[model samples]
Target: MKIYITSLLALLFSLVLNAQNLEKYEEMPEVDGVYITQNMFELLSKIDVESDDPEEQNFVELIKNLKGIKVLTTTNVEVGSQMKTDVNSYVSSENLSELMRVKKEGKFLKFYSKPGSTDQKVSQLFMFMIDEDTSEKRFVVLSIIGDIDLSEIGQMAGELKGVPGAEELKNIKDEK
Candidate 1:
C-alpha cells in the first residue's frame, strides 16, 4: 500500500509539472504591419493561473483575456542607429524579466512581460515585435495581459491577417 501510494504521489507530481508548462497553442497574432509574435507568448500559455505566485497568476489571467495581438516586418538587417537609440531607452525603462528576447536581428524586436512583483512570481509575458525598416517603423505586436478572451484574440487575429501592413510583419511560428 505504501509503495502504491508513493507511486501515485509521483504520478501526481509529474502531472502537475506538465500542467505548469505552457498550454494555449494558438498561432501568434499579427495586426496591420506591427510585428508582435514573440516566442514568450508560447511559454506564457502554459503557466497555471492558480500558482503560489500571485504575480504569475495575475499574468496568466491577463494572457487569457488578451483582446488582440499584432505583428510587424522590416527589411533592415540590424536595428538602425536611430531606432536602436529609441529602443534602448524603452527597453531600459520597461521592467520585466525576459524569459526569451531577440533584438537587432533583421530589423525585428520581440518582447514579452508580466507586470508583477519580482519577489513573487511573473504572471503574464506579452510577446510582440517591431520592424525598423522602410519609411514606417513601429512595434506592431502586442498581447494584452490578464484574463484574455480567446474568442476576442481569435476574431482580432483573423481580421488583422488581411490588413496592408500585416504583410510586412513577419510571423515566426513554432514547430510541433
Candidate 2:
C-alpha cells in the first residue's frame, strides 16, 4: 500500500511539470505585438515610460523586445508616466500580488493571486519576460502557488494563441 501511494504521488507531481512545454513556443506573425508558446502568450499590451520604480523600469526593459504592443484596455498610457498609473491600478484592482521575482536575471516578472479565494483553483504565478539578446518579450514562466486548477493557465495560454490581440484577451482573461 505504501509503495502504491508513493508512486501515485510521484506520478501526479510529474504530470504537473509536464503541463506546458516552453521550448515549443512560437511568436505569432500576423499579430504585431503578440507571441505564444504551447502554454502562454507574452504581449506588450501597452507601454509606459514615466515611472522610475524598479519594477516598472524592469518591466519596460523586458517588454521592449515585444514586436508590437496593443492596448486592449481603454487606457491612454502614451508615455511611461501613464503606464505607472496603469500598472498600479491593475495590481490593486486585480488582487494580483508579486510573489517570486526574476527581473535582472532575465526579463521575467512573476505575480500570483492568493489561493482559496473565490476565484477558481488556478493559483499560478505568471512571469513576464523579454529576451535581452533579441529584445523579444515572452510571458514564459509559471509557478504554482497553492492547490487550484493547474491547467487553467495553459488553457488560457492556448486560447491566446488562436485568437487575435485584444479580442483573444477578452475571451481568455478571467475578469472575476
Candidate 3:
C-alpha cells in the first residue's frame, strides 16, 4: 500500500509539472490573437532602447530581466468565451495566487502571480479579462514571466498599453 501511494503521488507531481509548460498555451486551438515569445521581447526591447524618449528608456530597463511574455485574445463571441474558460482553468491548475481584480463597465479583470525569490517580486504574472456586451464578446490572457518587481507592475502595464485589453490597465490608480 505504501509503495502504491508513493507511485501515485509521483505521477501526480510529474503531471502537474508537465501541465505548466508554456507550449501548452501557445498551442491552444482556434483562438486568434498575439502570441509573443522571449526572443521577440528581446528584439522589441532593443528597438525601444534606441528611442530618445525617457519613458522608452525606462521600458528598456524593465524588460532587461524578462524571460517571456504570452498574450492571447479573441473577439468572436463563441471563441472568446471558450478561451476565457480555458485560460482560467490553466491559471488555476498552475496554482498562481490572485494579486488583483477589477470589474467595471461590463468587463472583469483579474491578475495572478507566482512568487519570486523576494516578497516584493514575482516570477510570473498572469492577467485574465472578459468583456461582455450585447453585441460582442472579448477575452484576453497575458502571461509575463521573469524577475518582476511588484512595484513595477504599473510600468510594465504602461509599456504594454498597445496590446489588446491593456488599455484598461491605464486606469489603475496607485493606492499609495
Candidate 4:
C-alpha cells in the first residue's frame, strides 16, 4: 500500500511538471495567448455554410477533426527567450519531427509535426517563430492539435485572423 501511494504521488508530480509547455504563458501579463478548445471546434464544425465551394467544405471537415489550438505571443525579450527554451524542450520530449524551417521578411519560422494516418497528415502541427523586423523582437508559438490534412491547413489558417505564424501555414502545403 505504501508503494502504491508513492507511485501515485510520483505520477501526479510528473504530470504537473510535463503539463502543456505554453499553457503557463496564458496567464502571464507579458504574453498574449489564445486557446481554442475542442468544444469550440465541434461547434464550428456544426455551423452550416451555404457555399458550394469544395474548399469551404473541406475546411469544415478539417475542423471536425481538430482537438484544439493554442497560440502564445510575446514581445518581452526575456519572456521570449524562456518561451523558446520551453518550446524546444516540448518538441524534444514530444518527439515531434521537424517539418520545415523558413526565413522570410525578417521572420524566422520553424515547423514540427507528429505523424498521423498518412504521410500528408499530421496529428499535431507546432510552429515557433521570431520576428526581427521591428525594434522590439516578437516571439510566437502556435500548436494545433488534430488529425490535420496538410492540403487544407491553409484554409484553417486563413480563418484564424491575427494569429502570428498562421500565414506561414499556407506555405506548408507548398512544401509538401
Best by TM-score: 4
Quantify all predictions' global Cα lDDT against the true fold. 0.42, 0.37, 0.69, 0.87
Candidate 2 similarity to native, TM-score: 0.29
TM-score of every candidate relative to the true structure: 0.30, 0.29, 0.71, 0.87
Off by over 4 Å in 1: 1-64, 77-81, 101-111, 116-144, 147-176
- Residue ranges of candidate 4 with Cα displaced over 4 Å: 1-15, 158-162
Could you give the C-alpha RMSD of every candidate to the true structure, in order shown?
17.1, 17.8, 4.0, 2.6
Candidate 3 TM-score, true structure as reference = 0.71
| Candidate 2 residue runs with Cα over 4 Å from true position | 1-85, 117-120, 123-127, 130-133, 136-176
- Superior by lDDT: candidate 1 or candidate 2: 1
- In model 4, which range of ten residues has the least summed lDDT? 14-23
Please report how far candidate 3 places residue 52 from its true position, in Å. Answer: 9.5
Tens digits of per-residue lDDT for model 4, 1-176: 99999999997886677565667898999998888999999999889999999988998999899999888889999999999998898888778899899899999999999999888899999999999977889999888899999879976777767667778787687765
lDDT of 1 by residue, 30-99 (tens): 2124333335555676765566875555455545444334323233434333333433444444554443
Encode model 2's per-residue lDDT on 1-176: one tens digit a residue.
Answer: 99999999987775553332221222323222332331221334244467777655544443332232222111121322333343445445546665444445344343444454345543434333332323433232222333333234334345456332212223223533
| lDDT by residue (tens digit), candidate 3, 21-130 | 43454555655546556786677777734568866676676576688877776676676666666666767777888777888888788888888878777888788888
